[model samples]
Target chain A: MGGRAGLLIAPRILEDVSRGRDIILVTGTNGKTTTSAMLRAGWGGEVAGNDTGANMIQGHVAALCASNASRAVLETDESWMAVVISSLRPRVVVLLNLSRDQLDRANEVRRIALGWRECLAPETYGGVVVANAGDPLVVFAAQEARHVRWVDVPSSWRDDAASCPHCTRAITFGDGGWSCECGFAKPRVFSASVGATLEIGGESFEWGLALPGSFNEVNAALALTALAECGVEVATALTRLRTMTTVQGRYGLRRFGGRTLRLLLAKNPAGTAALLASLDPEDEVWIAINAQLADGRDPSWLYDVDFDNLKGHRVTCLGERRLDLATRLTYAGIDCAVVDEPESLQGEGSVTVVANYTAFREWMGRSTPC
Target chain B: MLRVAVILPDLLGTYGDGGNATVLAARARARGIEVEVVPLAIGAVIAPADLYLLGGGEDGPQRLARDLLVEGGFVERVRDGAHVFAVCAGLQILGTTFSIEGDASYPGLGLVEATTTRARARAVGDMATMVSGHMMVGFENHGGFTSLGTGVEPFGQVLVGRGNDGHVDGYRAGRIWATYAHGPVLAQNPWLADQLLSEVTGESLAPWASVADRLYLERCERVSTRRSAGDRTAGRH
Candidate 1:
């Protein structure tokens, strides 16, 4: 396990799942932890994950070792997917969308994708790939697999992949949800709402995530998909989805000092934007950027956020890389104060802190001292 | 109104590549430039944008994204000097074709005329590169291999961290600058971010001000600063 985080550990733990123990492996850039946790909760299964959100192979192994259950549902890292899948050969694999994450450590997106794709190959003892049908690569790879079952997109989300994986023609999106130009249509529906009514075909139920991002909806759908693949009734899964709790610090609301603070873990371009997109127009913000190796060394992707939604918000910045975060905010025309000191963040209003995963942890550790 | 469009695939584009547009809009507004951002997905109308950004996604997301782009012609339009910046998977999608493993090869946007292959190895952790043009320091964790075609201009030679594709990766076509470094690659290196803006708007930017910023600027001022000033001082002899 060395020094690997829980993200890395979930997969390794799943590798040791005993025979006939249904082990489910879930991996993606984001949503892995959330989807895995949600599925476990929805399925009422004893699950092992980086619910502490460590999300590394070492964390995977540790979580598995710590679990008393025979079945392990893991949130695998794209970096270690192949390595873990080769070792674990889990019963089912659920893959969420891939996005830019830890570029310094992840180098390129394809690198991680290749690792997952190789391990989830069809020839690998008939392993089932429960893939996102909306994503081109996932669907394309599913096409190559022997046992491929696709999960449709939630109603609130948009079909981001718009071309045929075979011919590279534009995929058509209509009331029917998603279809590729090459006649490769998928069963995914693009749904977007603050929350939605999920009809599990047996028992119609409604579940709402406290978070506002459309990405979270996709995460919820991915969770349901994993449950369905596990032979759990859709209604049973949907009914259970309502009783779940949000993972701590992944858009979790907390009371720090006197103000209500929202803690969001953002370490990449897509995640940051998704969090930014979901921000309340009325909330004040405190953005922290970490200089940690895991939080990413570069902060330029901050340039991609649409700060228009945050037209008149008071913003405070923290972290060793505070200037980078501050400057990016400054560049975005948001007036911000750089607090090189972490203690100053206390009593700082109902602030939304969008920081690296480590910065989020440090803030949580400091604000909610054990 | 200055309109910037961010084209994101499912995988790597999630983190905050969209934040780049927000930062640009804020900067443009501070400069009294009107700005608007339009997030474009696969089938959205390909509006002629002033600035185009593609972010990182998983390899499958990149392939799906590349296929989505193959029909849009927007990438070609971006390559025609619409001011394009691509990160991680974004950079991989710009290549002619990217291969995740030996069994599959997905076509790219073909903007930079390069090919990326997912190597049979994982290249993770911090890196110190020696890029050729400007000095940069960023980490690289990738399993892809990027082979730049002829007539391409590299972003820089790796000074201490990994370069374009985490190896000898480089940018090309003079206008477009692609790299594997993330963490909002421009977050710390505002100078390079400015360089990307300059590449698009054809304007020069003011110098960055910070101890690390100044050190990075000084490194940029001296091409061989890493080898000469750092621990390799004697090795430079």
Candidate 2:
């Protein structure tokens, strides 16, 4: 509401508020929240971050208004990148990766990347674009920037980039890099991670981080790359990033119903699949899903998620779209108990509760004493 | 083994429509019919299969898929009585011609006597159609509003949301089944899946019941019953 009123009273309020601040704009399908958190942590103090998951005008305004900080990291929604970029005129724009999520709103991944291309064009803005060298779509969008720092954020999800965005030709993703026949290929190397070694501009940093998932490490990588663009030393960024833990309560352990529950929020196919893939095969998982508007009313994307990741693990399905999820799981030869309560599931040790948007919030509420 | 080829999932499987292949293969295997699901990526040769499934995609990939299908002997195989199930952009790709971004119109496979053009508004949300004596429930998300040519039979009457034109949704002529519903429509409407499986195997499938599907169907009923679920506007993008 404040963001809207500010916009109405003064159309260029976002521009006004963002003026003179060294802003690092993070935009991507996944890892935006975690990356923003990492950026804030890497920058240590005096850095404002919009990590509330809203990522639009409301959250951006609120975050910026709360702080008179000299530096800020604003996580903008992938779809809202165009609007935010024009106003913020950020110093460094960090793109993690691109994939289809919340299809009802952003129907096509290409369209979002296209929007980014338009906003990040040389004529539009001049800033350092730190993007994922692993994702072709990210490469496509970040290609227009004057300065691009490509960081290889290792991701297993590649179903979204089956074809080249530039020529619509089939792209071949080899162990080395991905390339299309139409001269569109992974650009010249900048930085990459080889397991525990984080490579940035011919230099290496320790890969050890306080974050749980490899996805978080990817977030840290992008965040580190963005900080590098902002002239922060690699050693300083790594030390600060490793000291921080937890992101919007993600991977946060909390006791619930006589058991320790680890909360992981995965709202889209890429996110859920990545979460599922990163989990220990023997670990018990409670998969919660919902079709609320924020979660993209269509739960059909659940099919795209490889439940096979949980093949060796005991699984329980719950939440609003549990039936759809359970139905999807049954076909994958994984028999999961569908329970109305996550507490009812027979599990030992720390139970990993993976839920999409509303389900995550609802479960967080349930775990928190009413 | 009955092979269910999910063609160009990378190009056209954005909506999780590949789940339909999983549902089909699993259901078929449970009925004592061995099945193999072949995920056909681009440039892959078209193999013999009992059923070929195509899902929704963006405009560029949709046209690329149509052209690839033409060059990959997909139409010839379909002409030989192979079963094909397509949804949304898949439906558009199998048709005669479809318009995408701007005023640009691209040629389709011409396998189905249909043509898709950009509508004033896109039709989205819960769509229902009474098919095979039951409500075939699914969600429609597409900017293209399809119109069937003469003599082409529609899959069902539009009971909830705007389908093919508004009064109807989808195309069913011989072995090919196409609709605007994005992905996993088969899982939502298991009867439709069974009907397609039965046609492919040339065997009668026994009645199969699933607690999850039953619950899903009940919810689909509840959603369709509510006026808020369907396209309140004439169409939506």
Candidate 3:
């Protein structure tokens, strides 16, 4: 549905559907789907969303057509965010962290960030923007927004954000998060997750999420703040968020070829790092990397991932680019076997499968019992 | 111990180009040669090393890398004796000038007698080439269209995808090698890695059957078979 036909029909459909409904546009490199899911769950109303991860303009049209909800939480791809924002003029746009993802098809991180900065300038975007304060790129892009709600979501991976997007200077990271020597720093976070408690506007809400990792906690905080800006109560949003177990098959336990495995989707280095950080050091893990169109044709970004954290784990590499993963693992001093198939690997208990885009989708398709 | 310095890896080593350094170190270690992989950070003083490597990066970082290298006198050092392996943006920065988008061009280190201008379309796909009678398999993702001078020689001829500017793939002049092929180029071509190591250490390292070699062979077969079956459109970005 990515042809000229879909692009043409999307505008007309969006014009008709978004006439009266409040739209919340969620966009970023990583955590877009999961964060949009959290926002939808905590929206306290019937919300239209692209649950299948179809985040383009066509996807939005299909989603709006599928649901009759007055309020919608749309997950927009970073490259399409500017167009989508101009079309929808969303009530609360959640600008999550921006990082390199699909460099072969997408623009460079700083270029995209610069485009976002131009698109989200105060004169262009009058809506409230919920932005991540810890990521320097996100901070740079969202600072131009007319109204901004900054959330402190400390990033696990900073390689993509090693340099300032504004000045190209090396960014310094400390206990307070990242700051550029060029006078740009993390904004004052209006919403933040301190320990297990989510603090927003001086009010603290305690909740346990089924989604693992501090990244999800950050996602939840950002979503809750966006929901609040959309007039959803913090307590109500928290309750709805607590009920969410998974989004688009992520954090799912599925049986694959007689072995039960927990499926985690990591499309880029930052997401991969977050997924790795969420795992136990000794957990048996299988990484499936594919260089398909959906998974970014170039697997060069794999080198950016700090695989040193997976040193002690029994790791097996699987997928089309399994050899590449194995080669990378070898260089990282991590012992890993390159397996032709996931079933060939000998494991006693439930193994964790961290896969990129296409691989995760393929596994999800295979894991479903007929 | 063989000293290998990866210049400004934090800035220039995007595109998994760090794997080239890793392959060098691992291959050297496998050959009973102790290798020291030194990461020369931005603004660090360039030290004399037997081999120096640089990788690809975005325009901002590439320009920054070129400026730092010029200021630190690393370009002269590389020209003097160091065996250098550069990939994509690294190759561009080593040339006379690199024309980025918006028609803005930045001066390079002038280490290589070539100039890179931003191409009309970026070449992105699986790339194969014949380098020194050896089949080299890798990936190409670059927007620079490079033209070599009369004194410069290409590292290889393009076998599948567009390389350099649809004909040649890389430049090889004396001890320096630069390529747009960056599957960490060395991981997919162990022969080239060994050749570079041999040039640096002045010893012909025996060909050892490594797991990397097995992977390289498999990749070569895959690319060849795929091309034979007329599936040129299968992996192009």
Listed models, DockQ each: 0.28, 0.74, 0.57
Against the true structure, what is each candidate's TM-score? Answer: 0.68, 0.96, 0.95
Off by over 4 Å in 3: A1-10, A343-348, B229-237
User: What is the lDDT, from 0 to 100, of the residue B177 in candidate 3?
Assistant: 89
Which residue pairs in candidate 2 have backbone atoms (N, alpha carbon, C) closer than 3 angstroms, thus clashing?
B122-B236
lDDT of each: 0.63, 0.84, 0.84
Better of 1 and 3 by DockQ: 3
Per-residue lDDT for B59-155 in model 1, tens only? 5556656666767777667756687777767887777887764548877777778887766565543334444445464435556767788877666
Residues A50-151 of candidate 2 have per-residue lDDT tens digits of: 777768877788788889999999999888888898999999999988998988777888988889988999998888899898998888998988888888
Best by TM-score: 2
Question: Highest DockQ: which candidate?
Answer: 2
Fraction of true contacts reproduced, model 3?
A: 0.48
| Model 2 C-alpha lDDT per residue in residues B1-237, reported as the tens digit of each score | 898999898888888898889889888988999999999899899998878999998888888888888899999888887899999888888899999987588888888889988988777677777775777778888887788999999988777778887888889988899877753788887888888899989999998888546755766666566746544434533
Score candidate 2 by TM-score against the native.
0.96
What is the iRMSD in Å for candidate 1? 5.7
